[model samples]
Target: MADIVGSMRVFVRVVETGSFTAVAKENDVTAAQISRAVTALEEQLHAALLHRTTRHLSLTEAGSRFYERAKAILADLDAATDEARNASVSPAGKLRLHCAPGLAQSTVAAALVGYQRDYPDVTVELKIEQSMPNLVEDGYDVSLISATQLPDSIYVAQALGSAWSVMVASPDYVKRNGMPLTYDDLATHTLLKLETPVSPPDEWHLQSTDDAHVLPLTHAPLQVNAPDVMRAMLLNGAGIGTLATYSAVEDLAAGTLVRVLPQYRVRPFTVFAVYPSRRYLEAKVRTLLDHLRATLTPALEAVGERVEAMTNTIGEAAGQAAKSA
Candidate 1:
C-alpha cells in the first residue's frame, strides 16, 4: 500500500546509514515512519530484508542480494534523470547533423565553428552528402536541406534562407567566347553541367521578371557530380556552369567569375533546418538551429547582394558600350 519506489529509497537509505534513526534524521522524518516504510516494502516483497536490533542492523542473505540489485537500479534511474535534465538545459552529447555538400564547406561549416566555440559540451557529428538522409533512421538530430519542397510532412522546418543556382564563367572565357546575352545564346556555347541524384542533369530552370523557362542543355561537353569540381572547371575557362550562390560567392566577389545572365535568374530553392516533430526540442538541437539561421541567413543575403551588384555593373557597362557604338 505504501509507495513502492519511495519505500525502496527508504530501504536503501536505512541500509546505507545503518539505522532508521540516522536516515530519519537525515530526511527530517521520525525513525518510526522510516521503519514503517521498510515494513511495507518487506510485506510487498513477502521477504524479510533486514535483521534489526536495538543497537545493530544488518542485511539478511536475501536482503544482501536485493540490496545489490536495488542499489544498481536506483543509480541507473538517477543517472537517466540527470541526463535528461541536463540535455534540456545545457547543450551536451553527440548531435548528428546532415547537410547538403554544396553548403557544407562555407555556410554550415562556418556556423558549426561558432556553435562549438559557444557550446563546448555539445559534440557535433557532421555528415555532408548530396542526397538527403533519413533523419529518424540515421539518428540525425537535425538536417539542412536545399530544395523547393520539404521531403515529408513529419518534419518541422525552419527556413534558413533562399538558395539558387547561377550560371558563371571565368572573365577570360567571357572575353574570348562572348558573354551569353540571353538564354538562347547558351546553346551556342560549351556548357558544363552538374550531375546530381536529386535534379535533372542537363536541364536548368531559369526565371525572369515576367516569365520562367526551363532550358535543357542537350550538348553539354563536361558533366560532374561534385559542385567543387564544377566550380574548378568554370574557373579554368572550361565552360559556363551553374553554381549555387553560396558556392560561388567568393569567386564572384574577386571578379574571377562573372554571372552570365543578368536579366534572367535561376529558380530559387529554400534552405531549411529540419528536425523531427517531437514534443520537446532538446537544447542542443534548438541552439544549433538558431545558430544556423543567424549565420546562414546573413551569408546567403550577402551573396545575393554581391551578385546583384556585379550584375548591375555588367549591365551598366553594356549600356555604355551601346552608346559608344
Candidate 2:
C-alpha cells in the first residue's frame, strides 16, 4: 500500500542515520513510531534488519544489503519525480546570492531577468554589498566576486574570467584637468586616490608597462570605500577613479567616462563564482551561475577589447612624443 512505502522511507532513514531518535525528530514522529515501522518491515520481509545493542546500532548482513538497495530505490524515485516536475515547470526554490555591489548592479542584476524568465518558479534573493559575508553562517547559496584570487578556506569557485583595472574620469573632469597622456603625467595632476577594498586598505598596488609600483598614498582628495560610489564620482566628474573594467562597461559605452593613460593596463583581477561545492550545487544556484557565465562573458570581453584599443592609442601618442623630442 502507499502507507507501506512511506513507512519504508522512514525505516531507511533510521538505518542510514543510525539513530532512531534522529529520524523521529526529522519525521516529526516518536522514536517508538520508528521502531514499530522497522518491526513491521522486518515482519513483512521475514528477516531481521538490525543488530542492536544498548549503546550501538549495527546492520546485519541482510540489513546492510537491504539498506543499500532501499537507498537506491528512494534516490531513483526522487530523481524521477524531479524530472517529471521539471518537464512541467522551472526550478522552484529560494536561491540566495552574495556579490560585490558593482558587479551585481552592472552585469549580474541585468542577467537575472533572463534567468528568472527561464526558471520562473525560482525566487532569487541577492545581497549586494562591499564586504563578503560568511556564506555558511549567513545561509547564502552562492557568491560572485572580483579579486586577485580567492583564499583556500572560503569556497569552491569557477574562474569566470580575469579583468584588469582601468582609469576612468568623467568628460567634465578631463576637460577641467586635462587628461593624463602618460603615466608620468599622473604626478602633475591632482590624483584621485581609490581606497582598495581589500583587507589592507592603505596599499594601492598599481602596475604600468615600465614598472610595477606601490603608491603608499595615505590620503586622497576624496576616499569612497564602495566601488559603486567611486564609479558614480568618476561618472559625475567629481574626481577620477580606478575600477575593474567590468564595473565601467555601461559608462564607457554611453561616453560618460573615458579611459586614461591608455598604454598602461592595470594589473589583472579574476572574477569567480564561489559556491559551497561544485559537486553538490543546488538546482537554483547552479542555474543562476550558468546564466551569469553565459550572459556576462560577452559584455566583459567587449570591455577588455576597448581597454586594449585605448592602450594602443596611448602607445601611438608616446611614440609621436618620442619622435618629436
Candidate 3:
C-alpha cells in the first residue's frame, strides 16, 4: 500500500500535466521513471491508467476516475502527516547541493554551516566541482553557481546577488611597492591572474563611472585556479591579483587586504540558486534557498557599499593632498 501510494502521486501528476516529461521534471526524475511509476500503478490496480504516445499522454477512463480519488487521498495523507508532524512541519532528509569550487569555498560554505544550525533535520552534502553539472542527472537538490551569466537551461533559478572583482594586495605589499593610483601605474607592478569560471586569465577589464581600461600585463606568471587560493597568495604579498568581493569581504573588513584601485571595478559575476523545478519543491530545498537569499544578498550588497565608500575616501584624500601641495 505504501508503494502504491507513492506511485499514485506520480500517476496523478502525469494525468494532470498530460506529459511524463513534465512530471519527471517536477519530481527531478527521468521521464522513464515517471512512466514506470504510472505503469506500476496500473499493474497494482489491474487497470490501465494512461494512454501513451510519442506526442502526448491521455488519461484512460480508469485513470480519470483513479486520479480524482488519488488526489484526494494524497491531500488527506498530507493533512494527517502535517497534524502528526506538529506545527512546524519540519522537513527531515538528506539535502544535496552542487557548488563551484570558488563559491563553495567563499560564501556558500559559511551559509551551510549556519543553515545546519537552523535546520537540524537536514543533512547537507556539498559537492565542490569546477564545472556545472546537470541537476537532475547529478541528483543534487540544489546548485549554487557563480558566473558572469547563467547558461540557458530548463531548470528554475533564483539569483541570489552579484559580487564584484577587485584588485587587492597585502598591506605590507602596498607599503613597500606603493599604491597604483591610476591604471597606468599597474603596468609597472607585478601582476598575477586569478582564474574563475567567468574571468579570463590573460587580461583584466577595469571600469569606472567615467573611464574604461584594459591592462594586459604579460609578466609575473603566477595564476591560481580558485578565489580562496588567489586571496591566500595576495595575503602573503605574492602579487597584485583579482579577487571577488565575496571571497575578499572578510579580509577587507579586517584590513588584511586593501583594494588597489578603489575607483575602478575589474568585473562582476552573479550567483544563482538553481533547482530542478519550482512546483513541488522539497521543503528542505525551498528553505535553504530562502536562507541563502537572506544570507548572500546582504554580503553582495556590502561589497558594493564598501567599494563606494573607498572611492569617496580616496577622492577626498587626493583632494586634500592636492590642496596641501
Candidate 4:
C-alpha cells in the first residue's frame, strides 16, 4: 500500500498550493514525484481528489470533502510532531525541586535565579528539606543533596560540587581569644558545634599533610541542627564553629568571619543533583542540572580561593611575628 500519511500530506499541499509544481519545489521533490503521490492517493481513495486542466487545477465536489479531512489529518500530525519536539527541547511546566536546606541560601539560589531568568517558561517549585526525597515516589524532578556519600540507588547523581567544612570565627571572637595557630589551640577556644542528623554531634574533623585530627567538643557552648543557625551564632561571635563553605562564603568574603587553620580542612562533602534514572532525561531537569553545574561549581571554587587567601595571610602574619619575637 502507498504511504497513506505521506500521500495525504502531498495531496493537501497540492490542494493548498494549487499547483503540483509549486508543492514539488516547496517540498524539494520533483513535480513527477508530487504527481505520482497524488495519483496513488486518489487510486487508494477511489476518487479523483483534484480536477486538472491545461491552465489550472481545481478540486471536485468529492475532492473538497476529502481535502478538508486530509487537511485536518495533516494539521493534527504537524501539531503532534511539534508538541513532541517542544517537549524534548523546551523546558516548560512545573518542575518540583527538593533541595537541601542550606543550599538554597547559597549558590543553589543564585543558580536558580539565573535559571529562571533564562527559562521564563519553566515554573520551579523549590522545597528545602534536610533529608533526601525519593525522586520517583515523591514526584520530584530533582533533589539537591549534601553528603559524604550517597546511598546506592537507581537514581542518577550528578555532582554539582563539593562543600568543605571550614572552621570560622567572628572578628570579635578572634580578637578576644586570638587566632588559633595549631589544632591544639582550638581546645582553649569556645567551639560552637553543629549537630546534624547526617553527621556526628560535637566533633570537628580536621586533616592536614602529616596528621588527621578529630577535635572532640566535649563541652561545646552551643550546638544547633541547622547550618544557618550555626552561621548566625558564629556571626554573633558566639564561638568558633565549623561550617560548610556554602554557608559561610558571604561572611568570609565580607571579613565578618575568618577561616581558622587554613592548612587543615575537614572532610569535603559532595553536593549532588539527584534525579530518577531515565532513558530520556526531561529538558527542564537537564537545563537546571547544567545551570547548577556551571554556576555552583565556580561559586564553590571562588569560596575555596578566598579561604586560601585568608589562610595565607594569617600564616604570613604568624611567621612575621615569630621572626620579630
Each candidate: RMSD to true structure? 3.2, 11.0, 12.4, 6.2
lDDT of 4 at 72: 84
Residue range 80-119, candidate 1, lDDT tens digits: 9999988888899999999887888887888899999999
Model 2 spans with C-alpha error above 4 angstroms: 1-90, 196-200, 310-325
What lDDT would each prediction earn against the true structure? 0.86, 0.75, 0.82, 0.84
TM-score for each predicted model, relative to the true structure: 0.86, 0.67, 0.69, 0.72
Model 1 superposed RMSD (Cα): 3.2
Give lDDT tens digits, candidate 4, residues 72-142: 88889999898767876899888899987777788788888899899999999999887887788889999
Best by TM-score: 1
TM-score of predicted structure 3 = 0.69
Model 3 C-alpha lDDT per residue in residues 1-325, reported as the tens digit of each score:
6498889888877877788899899989999988887788788889987888899788889888988889999999999887545423465688989998767876788889999899998899999887778889889898888888877889998889987788889998998899998889998888988767776788898888899987786876688777777788899988799877767767877889988888788877788888999876677887898899888778768766876676578679889999999
**Span of 10 residues, lowest total lDDT, candidate 2:** 195-204
Better of 1 and 4 by TM-score: 1
